[model samples]
Target: MKKLNKNQVYGFIAIAVLSLGVVGCKATSSVEKTEDKTVPEMFAGATKDTLNSGVISWKTYFKDAYLQSLIETALKNNQELNITMQEIEISKSEIKARNGEYLPFVGVGAGASVDKVARFTNIGAMEATTEIKPGKEMPEPLKDFKLGVYANWEIDIWKKLRNGKKAAVNRYLSSVEGKNFMVTNLVAEIANSYYELLALDNQLEIINQNIEIQSNALEIVKIQKDAARVTELAVKKFEAEVFKTKSLQFEVLQKIVETENRINFLVGRYPQHVDRSTGTFNDMVPNVVSAGIPSQLLSNRPDIRQAEFELAASKLDVKSAKARFYPSLGISAGIGYRAFDPGYLFKPESLLYSIAGDLMAPLINRNAIKASYNTANAKQIQAVYKYEQTILNSYIEVANQVSKISNLEKSYSLRTKQVEALTNSVSISNELFRSARADYMEVLLTQRDALESKFDLVDTKMQQLNAMVNIYRALGGGWN
Candidate 1:
């Protein structure tokens, strides 16, 4: 065995002392472990069907071809969706940047410089007297040239760099989930707006029909006034009813234009007539909705998943921050050749190489490290609360929609019967007025009631369709 040199023994002692210092250093303050709230097993007042509509493809769930086409266009061209896609790409770039931090950086470099020293100085006097050969002297006004490969690396002894990279990976996944959540919302908004446009079309049709009926009643009133069976006031009342109904049609027409424009905006284009089947608007029945178990929402809802990922990333951030209190290790090295003249640069006599290691720990003025650690802990807690809130919000939305669907179904059925009775009453009142058995006011009242009832029926059906779309959104459907 060879004997140990004093320099080597001293170097080992210095490393031991630094390692001890690292072990002795304590975090300024300890952080509490993060805890997340649990989700409910079942929704309130909901049957556990185990078959969530959220898993169904949007194309299959929404059978209307026009609506399907609109959603497809929005997914590709909607400005908001496109913007989120760019955010995802940005997050991807962050992941790459983080991944590069823990790895060694190696590069090559070359440089040239000229230097001169006074003759009275120590180096100048030595150069003047030194001989390169039997009669040769050192060169004056020296020109130095050098080339070398160099490397620098931070040793991740406490996993700080790796944790940062993992956190970035989680954030990238969170951004993707954010895009999925947007898709779900965009699809629902377009669908609800499409249904609203159809309702307006139906309302316009109803107004036109009512106008014709009122005009005919006005004519009958004129005949009665000629026969002296009714006064001129009765004729005027019928004429006013016809005018009012005619005005309503224009209002509905304006709404149709506005709703169509809204759909066009969502489709990322200029306003144009939206293609839809108004003929089936009244005949269309809302599909049955089934809400699966509440626990399934954790996996079904993209917002919830997004929050979960953010929580994971925040936890990793806390670990990375805490590592700041510990010692860091780094290594740097370079090897090449240099000489006064370029011709001697590659010679063995001119060879040069150096390597070194650094060990550092935060021993004083560590308030910044402490603050960063505390901030990371706070963000982790915030993420936990956000995760729980998303789950709760998803459950509440599904519950409300389920309740609304049941109530709206009952309301629609009753409104249909009311419309039927009011429609028949209009005919009865007209016949009685012609026979002088009912007052003129009675006929006008019956017509007004019938029109209002029919309007209510259409409005109820629209609400039913809207509830269906909203529940699908709340359950996190449409993204897939």
Candidate 2:
């Protein structure tokens, strides 16, 4: 073999290094363009600076033990969330598939063929195949046996393969963020439902208590009627009021069952009892939220992060498409031994080898390349706007939740006072009915007002609870 001249060795090394640099640049560019978009304004809030208290851990965030258990169970079994887990697995497989393209494809092939040609054909009349054995001579038109290994690779001069691989990687990461966003929404939903269940329980208990109060008033009226302090009409009216309370109690009970089922569905379980604490909902406190700087939201919110990844992936696809317009280089080689006899297959003289390099660029039929490039550009623009829209959405969500948290807290507190006053009126009006100073009409109105106040109080409490849940979700909690 002739030794390569010094200049030839240097040229070869330069080409190799240049090819490697091209591949590296394509991979690096995929995710780096995200820095171009403007930062968004964070949700409207009193605190523009975020309180980066240690990251939220659900175990610690939910001090309520029952709530913690419910959340843990939901994470394990929630159907939609579990399905997203499978989607992430699919994305990971896609990444592997794309990454594989940068490397060579190797395969082996084996074949044996025998054929008889017609004597009328020109080649058939001139040639015949023969095999020599110890005691036998084989004659045929031709019988060939072949075995070989082959490999093919595209030298990524324009880094199309590497860019495609990076795009796959970005998409995989986007899927993960998508799952996280789902997780945040899921946790918020469960928390909201849990709070509603508690509110329902509280309302039911209030109804039962009011029933007892109304029943006592009815008994008093009956006694007064027998003693001639009031007429039988008053007793009938009081009795009706007591019956109405009983009816409402059943309505609340039905609500409790339905709420249980709703929660059961979310937890991915059969309709069954949900362990709960029906303690005073009045004691509930809305979790405080600091609507961190808009920039921080870019990282904290999974939806935003997912959008960023998709944007990065789109840009990479554009680069890959553009690369199609550039020249592509490929190299392949094959080395093996072949012979008519199996014994001679490995002999040096029987060796057959081939190597080739190719450079190709689209010349006439570049419509495909043009179409791809145009589509990639369109998609890249779409991703840019989508990324911007996500930022806007995140900001709006945080702002709305913050307003809800503040306004609802104030509204809930005032409602608590309204309920307190109405509750006292119910007691005073009933006591007066027994003394004949207040009539059945007054008693009935007061009873109705008290019940309404209780319902309103529960509704307000639900809002406060929901605000807390929403604020947490808006701040990008629960994924961790």
Candidate 3:
């Protein structure tokens, strides 16, 4: 046997150490750009002393029992929301896969194979001359059987696999926030539609009452014509007005049907009557909303939080991609039994085992890795932009709803007085016409104005309620 001398052995060790140092020096870049994290102290000049409505639970926020029920049903059954839940599950599975990438993978397996060699080959001639035992010849064909447990693992020296798993975790949390945002919207939609249905019911009742009033006026005009106090044209005008009111009643009924169906759709059910308080629509007042500081939106709004998670995930993805440019160390091992025949597979003489490791690095044609790293960086930037946009949008939505609620309150008050005056005028005009003290045209106009004012009052009230629901949603309520 030959062996190396001490000097040669020292030189070999030095070369091995230099080789490790060269391979361990990664070429990946670690430069990351800064992101904006600024937010206003207040939203639409709101004071910081007020409490944010978003922290309130949906059950406490929505006082209407029917509306609360609808929201609950939607959260449980809405197709879009269910789909978002599935996406969350998928993200969770991705986390598992990434975690597995950095952990040892172990498995057991068994296999059998047969091999044949030609007599004219070198191995065939040697086999013909060989003897397995003193008087036995080697077999013409070989049969192999094996059974083993094997394992492979990639050492995450640079935290690449760990970062990938963290990214998946972030994405999973983002999906949860996405579902919460959807809940907010769904609750708002159902409430809005429910209020609209109530408004339509009120409008329909108003139209029907107006139609009866016009019919009586028509009767009076016909009586006046019979007495030669008015011409046929006046009677015909009153009759046409009655027909118009009846037609309007049908239109309002159609709206009611559509609104009910819309609510049913939101609740993920078939079209049917939506339970609501139709008579109380006029008495329904908008809920008082308190706007907290704009900075609170970071924690209050689900979309904002979702964007935040997505940004975090993207940042982690960039780290994982950058790590790809460095060398990766992998180890594999197997313990097994192998023999030329199945009878000998489990014997101690057939026992076999092996272990190996490799260090791999991109030394040539690294365009693919560079592109992936660049793409990860770009996505991180995009996530930052999206995060900022979500915050901006949340602030604007709350501000707009706040203004809308204030304006609607004033408008509704004015409309109430207008309705009262027109209603009185309607009665006065009818009495004057009956006594031949006012023109038939004046009576008709007063009745029409009064009916319209009543409808407007209902519509304004509906707007007030809708504004309240929207503000709650904007503040990220109904998702807790």
Candidate 1: lDDT of 389? 83
Count of backbone clashes, every candidate in sequence:
0, 0, 0
Model 3 poorest 10 in a row by lDDT:
21-30
- Candidates in order, TM-scores: namely 0.94, 0.86, 0.93
Candidate order (lDDT): 1, 3, 2
Query: Which clashing pairs does model 1 show?
Result: none
Quote the positional error of residue 292 for candidate 2 in Å: 2.9
Per-candidate alpha-carbon RMSD to the true structure = 2.8, 5.7, 2.5
lDDT of each: 0.91, 0.79, 0.86
User: In lDDT terms, how accurate is model 3?
Assistant: 0.86
**In terms of TM-score, how similar is model 3 to the real structure?**
0.93
Best by lDDT: 1
Across 162-235, the per-residue lDDT of candidate 1 in tens digits comes to 99999999999999999999999999999999999999989988898898888888999999999999999999
- lDDT (Cα, 0-100) at 150 in candidate 3: 96
**Model 3 residue 164 lDDT score:** 94
Clashing pairs for model 3 are none
